[model samples]
Target: MVQTARVLTIGEFSRLTHLSVRTLRRYHEADLLEPAVVDQATGYRYYGVDQIPVAQVIHRLRELDVPLSDVQRILRTPDPGIRAALVAEHLQRLEGVLDRTRAAVVSLRRLLEPDPAPIHVELRSEPARTVAAVEAVVGSGDVEAWFAGAMAELEAAVGDAVTGPPGGTYDNALFEQERGHALVYLPATAPPRVGRVHPVTLPAAELAVTTHVGEHDGVEITYGALGTWVVQNAMSVAGPVREVYLVGPRDAREPAAWRTEIGWPVFRLT
Candidate 1:
């Protein structure tokens, strides 16, 4: 008769793996890890000693910030080459996220610890311009992918007119409904429509604008600060927010050098 492997209960397995019961439960829900046996009476989970390797792999992948869907795909792949390729792709994504996070931390630190020089809010008039743009209704979760595609389209369309950097505008309804419209554009003489192309005219407006130097993802915090400034200074918003990307990913510049202008149009209190 063949002998079965020893099975450990959830608590026992958690101790062995140094993972919390809650984390193990979440892994089980995500289908990233599963137990070897389950009790029929109480539905308690039991894990085989042999399953530790799989659990460790899942833990490491998650520590690397691999998306759950990608983790499932990587685990399901049987070929060594394919698995390596999948891991490489995930590593690239992780690096990008880490870079963005580091930039945000630096920016936040600067904001919290400012120099003696006072931060000035400037009111400026912006001129309207035609741009080659891609518009999409995107949620916060899906904005990264949508932005990648939109930026790729903008770079391709920009020939001689790439003089100024690219930027985007977000409508207010998006954050409220989890569905927001984003228009990524480059200044252009004529709109190009190879694919996912649209023409948008940014209207002239008087805006209270402040420059932020760091990752675009963390610009929301800066916006909050700016909004507070507007309200305290007796100003009400009049139009959608504009984010002008003075420097971008395509420029191959340092992360600290990336500049974004957060512009909020406003009207003074009566």
Candidate 2:
């Protein structure tokens, strides 16, 4: 076949593709990409202009840390939608990593504060009541997704019957062992049983309460501070910790305006 597209030597191809000459040789060895033509006498490699786009695509995929096998599959796939879907899956994973990194940065900043603002706490006795709820054994990593789904179901089930702000009790094992029962609900007079939503009786208990402001990512910091205070004081945790959403995403657009009350059931230590 006659060569129609302009051909460039290995050095020129490297410049156009922005790929190192040595890396191009490795791609050839891996069967990822091959030069359009090679000199029989001198063993020199030549690439066609059309291959520049292919090389660029490979470069981009490598930059994203996409596995070599996936990149090869992407390039070989004929369907545009399938190729896009494969890339989207990797992007979703990257987004999860970014979210965790942002949370870590927030935590580190809070921890490194020289003179952090004191966490305010209060002691209160709560009355027992039956509330509309959704309960599940949830993994710590899956809590966010589970909470969103369960809350949607709970809201749909109770609707106008809601009597108080939404709240949840998280058992120690959920955080300590990464999986345990989690109960989320809102106070209601007579909550109907729907799907996973049901009436759960909340037992009355003494609590050490503190409010966590802003987003929930940093709520763990407040938990640490509150736990420290509990140990220093004359109290010990007696049961699952409760969180009452006073002002949240449902009520406001700004995370800065959100308020969550964290209550740890406790009893005075001798």
Candidate 3:
């Protein structure tokens, strides 16, 4: 009689892997992972010692919340680079979810806090200025990325000739209805013809202005307060809203130090 390599039973494998027997069975049922051997008569499952690493990898990916289908693809792929790219893509998605979660927390905190701060608004007569701008119609979900990219292009086009802070004009539909036309501009002395950056004169207007400090996650609070002030003072909105990035991301590394000036085109009643 010849002695053979000892195969661990499902119970032993479960203990060694620190995974519940039920989960291992579920994985087997899903075809994501299967036992090394199964007793035909008893229907008992066993795993080879060599499969420990495979089980561990599956556990690690599950801990990261990778989708089952993606995990299956990752495990089935023989190319190391492809596996790494798959993991990286999932991590990138997780990062985006984290960003949205943080923003949601900020908005919720603003809503729950008592004694909303007073909004100080000023009337300013803005003069028309020449700007290198990019215009697009975008959904609210894509505004942040679009604004950042447009601003980058405008900044690159205006390089060294930027005369004033960066600003954006947003149609009312953007805030009220979630989709609209948007324009991001950099005031500069340069002429048009830099990529999508084109020369345009921002129209002069009487604006009700207020400054928002910190990241835009909670900037909606400032906008609401300003809107209330405008209505209470008998002012009617005349046109699209303007946002001036005074101490923006381009100037400061910390979001808390960023300053944005919000200007609503308004007509004051006598």
lDDT, candidates in the order shown: 0.81, 0.92, 0.89
Candidate 2 minimal-lDDT segment of 10 residues: 1-10
Error of 1 at 100 (Å): 5.9
- Using lDDT as the measure, the top candidate is 2
Residue lDDT tens for model 1, 118-223? 4468888898888888898889788888988888877877777665778888887776677888788888767777678777788898899998766677677678
Q: On residues 1-270, what C-alpha lDDT tens digit does candidate 2 reach at each position?
A: 434257888899999899999999989888999989977767778899899999999999999889999999999999999999999998898887787888789888999999889999999999998999999999999999999999999999999988989999999999899999899998887988988899999999899999999889889999999999899997999999999999999999998899999999999997
Per-residue lDDT of model 3, residues 170-264, tens digit only:
99999888999999998787746678899988899999999998888778888988999999999999999999989977688998899999999
Report the number of the highest-TM-score candidate: 3
Error of 2 at 49 (Å): 1.3
The C-alpha local distance difference test score for the whole of candidate 2 amounts to: 0.92
Cα lDDT over the full model 3: 0.89
Residue 69, model 2, lDDT: 94
Question: What is candidate 2's CA lDDT for residue 107?
Answer: 83
lDDT of 1 at 66: 80
TM-score of each: 0.68, 0.85, 0.88
